[model samples]
Target: MANSLILSYLPRGSVVHKLTGTTKLIVFLLFSVATMVTYDTRVLVVFLVMSLAIFKISRVHYRDVKLILWMAFVFLLLNNLFVYLFKPEYGVEIYQSRTLLVQLIGPYTITAQQLFYHLNMTLKVVVVIPLALVFILCTDPSEFAASLASIGVSYRIGYAVALALRYIPDVQRDYHNINQAQQARGVDISGKDKLMDRLKGSANILLPLILGSLNRIEVISNAMELRGFGKNKRRTWYAKRPFATRDRVVLILGAVIAIGSLIFTFWDGSRYYNPFI
Candidate 1:
């Protein structure tokens, strides 16, 4: 199960792959802030495009990105649904004009404003998702742990972060296998089954998955204890390497971008302040 999600972690030789995990993490947080500060569709679109360009340079495969794209699409669909339902007026107000796009059956009308709102939301995901994926996929887990320690996180905490990142793919694989096993047992999870029955079947799958995960966690904890995970006031890393000049440049660039974004937000008074009125 761990292997399945971890397989998506591409081993690459790009500059991004060589970057210290701590630096990458700081940059990722900054980019996330910049993304969240603006509601302007144009700004978000520009950032999203820039992010995609970085993804291309990082050399992560297209297939891996496809998963993120699918998730983003689902988010966009749900965002539009909610906006068009309860806050249709706010969506209509964003573009500062009422321009009808299409009218669906059952009294639902799509407007330009709603379209732009959904577009902006999608763009936000686009800008953040690639960087998030790149940081995880490119950095080795052990190296990341060491980098985290250098940044003042305890070694134990750093290890936990790596484990958590690895756990995501593990859980996804476990869920798939559990679903298949349930299906093999003549559990009807399809459209043919009643909605309540399907829900119950899914809940049943979760039981074993949760138990399995807890067991795995216990095993890891015991192994760490055996090795004196927290016994030493200092820990040594086999993969530890000093950050290079290039790394410093990257960190500086990230800081500049973050600071510049904040400055622009404050100066224009349009960062967190959405001037829809």
Candidate 2:
């Protein structure tokens, strides 16, 4: 079940994994801002390369992220389809030019500008996904909570965030176990089953999963209350890590990149790079 989970921190000794959670969080934030601040294709390509480089440094296997990558592509495809369906001339409006490449129907013509705009949109997602994966895969949930607390976030809120992240794998494991149990009782959710049958069988597992999750939540709440978990305004984190030289360097670099993107993006007086000009 751990193998099937979307995002659980991997215990790797890579350079990205060695950074403190605070550093990773801050750098990720900066990278995200930089990515969103520009529609410049060249800047996005740089960010996309940087994201891949960071992902490689993290030593997370493709198998670990294959499912998520597929999901992301599927989502990107659907999003692009919907965007074109609803607003066919969106790119023409943005780039202020429409060099028609093909005419599918009345309002569904394809243009170079539209393809270019969508290319930028695709690059944005491609750039951000890897960085997000690196941050989530490399940082421990407890350390992430500590990072939030170190940045002046409430410990209770930080702990809640940690719990949610930790629960993702737990919930997946529960679903797997429940699915297996039901299969033992002659239910078929395997590929051998019809699509509708598999879906119904899966739905059946949700009730028990929800009940089990609620029971676990109650047990955890009781234990926390007994230990006076929120009695004080501050709490110590055993996983808290201090910033090191590498962390400082990464943060400085990230800040520069973020600010540079903003400046470069607005320098031409528009976020969109008008090569059509």
Q: What is the C-alpha lDDT of each candidate?
A: 0.77, 0.92
**Per-residue lDDT of candidate 1, residues 122-186 (tens digit):** 67777888888888888877788887888788998988987887777788888899999999998
lDDT of 2 at 108: 94
Give the C-alpha lDDT of model 1.
0.77
User: Which candidate number has the best lDDT?
Assistant: 2
The residue pairs that clash in candidate 2, if any, are none
**Worst window of 10 by summed lDDT in candidate 2:** 1-10
Score residue 200 of candidate 2 by CA lDDT. Answer: 94
TM-score of each: 0.75, 0.96
lDDT of 2 by residue, 199-229 (tens): 9998899999999999999998999999999
